[model samples]
Target: MRQSDKKASFIELGKFLSQFSEKGNHLNPEVKNNDRFFDNFVSLIELSQSHNGWFTPEQVYFSVQSWAEALTESNLDQWLSRYDFTNITSKTVGLILAGNIPLVGFHDFLSVLISGHKVLVKTSSNDQKLLPFLAEYLISVTPEIASYITFTDGKLENFDAVIATGSNNTARYFEYYFKDKPSIIRKNRNSVAVLNGKETKEDLVNLGEDIFRYFGLGCRNVSKLFLPKDYDFKLFFEAMYEYGDIIHYEKYANNYDYNKAVFLMSRFELLDNEFMTLKEDTSYASPISSVFYEYYDSADTLKTRLEADKDQLQCIVSNAVITDSIPFGKTQHPELWDYADNVDTLDFLIKI
Candidate 1:
């Protein structure tokens, strides 16, 4: 298919996705594949929790809404404007997706296809349903797309290059396994927030969204905080109270109980609000239902530290308090140009 055709199909896919949301959902009759895809997608959204307990309709819909806003023609055109696709070849790109939150690997899948390459996807077992269902919708809208997309359950084979996402351990294996192929192998990276004591209640409240969205399962979710020395967390805790109900979920509550117990047994000081725990620790990758924090005396020193550990970070949320840091609550709803790990995926795909 031509690049224009590929872009048009994704823009339509975006419109189809725009119908579903956390508060409301409606199928637009004008959408090309709605006759067959509408009802089935609603069923899949309902069945998503059964497939993976984390894929609740609210979270799934949020993911859908984010993608819907992102895949617009304007966004696609602006994001792709820097690339020249004239030299692109129709090579097959193997995609080993991650099932962390919803559609975590969709960007890579889109990148390969939009660059005029075939995509051979191996869906993460945790996220097997949603992407394939959408792929079917895409093929329905643009029949030519059926020739460009494939989902495989077996080991990936016969692909010129690969994009894989996994934990650090799996990354080591991917490094050795795809040694010869042009590839993007992602590892576990977490986002962190740098907070000054001057933050207003609303700033801290929005920060809660950064922490609790996706139940802190996504790499973009803020798992840690850097507080100014002697900063009181009373306001921060008060603001985060809005998300206190997250503890009602079995998985999050289980993690809260387990991690809190482990911390208690280790005699670490913890600040608990009956739902989430705040601990003074240096780790960037905190467990669910908990956020680790560290006190810094100097912003310059901390900025230097963050720069030194950039590879361990997916985002740095602040009031632009640190260089290149994103504003609070914007981490999860990244723009198309916000490449993960600062690696330009489109550049990788085009070159390969």
Candidate 2:
């Protein structure tokens, strides 16, 4: 199929997605393939939590709406215009998606097809429904590309290359198995925030969205905070209080109960506001319903440490406190070009 046709199909898919929201799901009769996909997708979003408790309607709608904004014709054209497609070669690219967040690995799937390569996808058990349903919508939009996408439940075969997302441990296994084939293997990494204690209440409240969205299951969620040596939590906790209703969710409340009890039993120092707990730790990955924090003496010193640990970090959220840091609450709304692990997926696909 032509590149224009490929881009158009995805843009249509985006328009279809634009109709859904946490408040409600609306169908625009003008969007093609709505009859086939619209109502069924609403039911699927409602049923998502049964498949994975973390997939609440609010979070699922946020994910759906974000993609709707991103997959516009202009955004897709701008992202694709940077690469040359004159010498393209088609290959089967295998994708091992992560289910930590809704539609987490959709970027890789989009990249392969846009680059003129077919894709064989292995959806994470945690997220199996959404992508395939969208894939069917794409085929309906452009039936000529029906053979371009496939989802497999068993071992992947007849694929020329692969892209896998998993933990640091599974990365080891992927390295050994796909070592002979060209691949991009992603590992576990967490995002962090740096606070100078001058951030406005609004800034901290937006930061709460970054921390609490997806119930803090996504790698892009801010899991750790770096504060000045003697910074106060009065304002931070107050800002976070806006999301206090999160504890009403049974799954998150259960985690809050269990992790807090463990911390109390261990005699560790903690700051609690009923819904969440804050503990001082040197680690980056914090448990659900809890956030780890550390004190830093100097911004320059923290920059050096972050540079050395960039491989283990996805992003840094700050109000320009650190260079190249993502602003508060924007991590979850990444553009099509914000490749995870700082790797250019289109470039890799074009080469293979």
lDDT of each: 0.92, 0.94
Q: Return the clash pairs for model 2, or none.
A: none
By summed lDDT, which 10 consecutive residues of candidate 2 come out lowest? 33-42
Clashes of each: 0, 0
How do the predictions measure up, each by TM-score?
Answer: 0.99, 0.99
Candidate 2 displacement at residue 212 in angstroms: 0.3
Q: What lDDT would candidate 1 get against the real structure?
A: 0.92
Question: For candidate 2, lDDT tens digit of each residue in 238-309?
Answer: 999999999999999999999999999999999999999999999999999999999999999999999999
Candidate 1 weakest lDDT stretch, 10 residues: 25-34
Cα RMSD for predicted model 2: 0.8
TM-score of 2: 0.99
- lDDT (10s digit) by residue, model 1, range 1-352: 7999999999999999999887887878888878788888888998899999899888999999999999999999999999999998789999999999999999988988999999999999999999998899889889989999998999999999999999999999999999999999999999999998999999999999999999999999999999998998889989999998898889888989999999999999999999889998888988888899999989999999999999999999998789888888788889998988899999998888
